[model samples]
Every structure is written in C-alpha cells, then in structure tokens.
Target: MALTTDTLRIGINKITDQVDPMGAHLNELDGRLGDGDLGVTMVNGFKNIAAVSDDLPDDFGMACMDCAKAMTKVSGSSFGTLMGISLMAVAKQTKGQTEIEWDRLPDLLQAALDAMIARGGASIGDKTMLDSLTAVIAATTGKTSAQDALAAAAEAADGALIEFFDQPCKIGRARIFGDKTKGMDDPGMVAIKSMIDCFT
Candidate 1:
C-alpha cells in the first residue's frame, strides 16, 4: 500500500500509543547507563508528534516535516534531537509526494539513517540509535511491503541489542559508564525496536 498521509498519521498515532507505556521502562534502562530521562523524552516527543499530525498537510512529506518540528519543540535531549533530524531528512527526500511507494521506502529510510549519523556523529558499534537504525535500513533493503520491512527491522533490532549490550558504549552520555555499560541494552536501540514493532 502507498504510504499516504492518513496512513502516516495512523502509524504516528500507533507509535505514540506503543511508546507511551514504555516510558518508565525506558527511564529505568537509561538510569543504568545515561541520564535516566530517555523514556520521558520519548514520551514527550511522540506526544507532541501525535498532537500535530492531524493538522499537518495531506502530503506525507509535509506531515513528516511537521511532526519533526513538533518533536523538536518538546524534545530537550540529544536522542530526541537526533530523531527529529532524521525525520526531517526523510521529509526532504520525500518532499512533494502524497504517498511513498513501497519500493522507495528503503531509500527514504537510508536517507534518514545517513542524516542521523552525520548529525549525531555516531556509527555502528557506538551503541547509539544508529545501530538499530542501520539494522532497519539493512532489513528494509529490497523489501516490497511495510509489514515485511517492519518485521525485519524489529528482528534486526533484537539481534543488534545482543551484540550492542555486549560492548561498552562508545558514544553519547552512556559512554561515561565505560565497561559498566556492558550487558545493558542501549535505551535508544530499545526505543527504535519499540517504534518499529508498532508497524508490525
């Protein structure tokens, strides 16, 4: 199916619904390695996105841009800022389109991933959202449907966590924990997994 504005709104609402309940858990996870505010940041960001999604224009790209703006308005943390920037990059690639074709999803996702890495200076094995975002892009490559892409992304995220938690964080606030971060999942990766799961 084409990724229309209505469908995009539904997905954003689903993400808000899915992420709202995970705030406390995310905070708990963040407490182990970071500032312990990841959950609250995510909850607030999605809440803002949901609030403005309906008022966004019918074009999927414009709606995404609006959501990014809304997210940036309420997101005070680095992770939230990265998320907003990634969405904005995707919006730029998809500008003027009412719906994204299934075949083009991977390219759009890749654009977002590249932008996130450039803006955040994080790479694979850094234990940042980039790990999960990379996995999602890899999983979506050549996929023909959103369901398939989402499922692959969720699985990739799950697998990525196994290795990510085994290594100490090399970037972000979590890096301060050094070896102590070992065996603890990156809160950002977990959040990515949760968001993708909403699409499945």
Candidate 2:
C-alpha cells in the first residue's frame, strides 16, 4: 500500500536535484514560447523538500499528503500546482499504507494521471509533463523493477514528444509555437523523461 520512508525520501531528493535539470531541458526546448522558469520553479520547489524531508509521513498515504502540501507551499508555478494535486490524488488512494505493493503501482500512477488531467485540464499528447509521465507510466506499469520501468518510460516520453510536435498546443504559451514547435519537443516532457531516466 505504501513504500518505505526511505524510498519516499529518495523520491523527494530526486525531484529536487533533477527538477532543475529537467526544467533546464524544457526551458531550452520551449523557452521562447513560455516563461522559461520551469527549471527555476521546480528546482526551488524541490530544494524546499530537503529541509522538511524528515517530516515526511511515515506511511505512503501520509507521505503523499505531505508531498502535495510541500510542493504547493514551495512552488508557485503551474507545474508545481499540478504536481501537488497529483500527489494529493495518490495520497487519497493510498490513504493508510506502509509499503506499496508493487502490483498496485500502476493504479497509483493512473490515479495521479487522473488528478493532473482534472487539475491542469491537459489531455494526453499535450507535450507537457503529463505526456512524459503518462508515457513512463504506461511502460512501467507491468515491468518488474523501477529501473526497467523507468527505462521504458524515458523512451516512451521521447516518442510521445514526437507525437506532440504535430499537435497544436491546447493549453499553455507553447500554443504560440504550434506548427513551429514541430521538432522542438516539449520541454516539460523532456525534463520529466530525463528525471525518470536517471532513476531508472
């Protein structure tokens, strides 16, 4: 039902250290279209996690709650709000568990996907972090290990980005680039995919 506290901590750390780099990737890819602050925002958001990492809930459900609160508190960006709400969804599903059953991870991830969709109002193939995250989730769902799953996710994210280039943005500033975004790949997708690549 929940992962160990240690895994949760690592997840938080991974977000902090990788979020910026991922943001950097997105900024480079879509900076001309957007505010170019995805990296800075994610970096700052994750940085704050380290300070309160010790306060992470002992169980997975509680941990999710804590994570959402922390992200909302630390980040003032669109992505942060989405991430926070996503975690809140996960927390809701995993309400009181100590270790997540590997088999249930897919459900957890799917729940998160639903949360983001509901909050951000972005559909699949939007070239946003959701695209990347969804791709990874699809690939990792039935895989045996986080490493293998993440590897699949990264590759999937890359492919998803390609698909996104053909569609005009429906939600954010990236919409301006529409046709010109043809080969650029969404920055958010790249960043999220890269982070999964590292963990995988």
What TM value does model 1 have? 0.95
True-structure lDDT of candidate 1: 0.83
Query: What is candidate 1's lDDT per residue for 55-166, written digit by digit as tens?
Result: 9898778888998888887645687888889889989988888978877877887888889888888887788888877777787788888788777878988888886878
Candidate 2 residue spans exceeding 4 A from truth: none
Pick out the ten consecutive residues of candidate 1 with the lowest summed lDDT.
Answer: 71-80
- Alpha carbon lDDT of each predicted model: 0.83, 0.73
User: Compared with the true structure, what per-residue lDDT tens digits does model 2 show for residues 1-69?
Assistant: 235767879877776666665667665655666887776667776776666788887777888787777
lDDT of 2 at 193: 66
Q: CA shift at 106, candidate 1, in angstroms?
A: 1.7
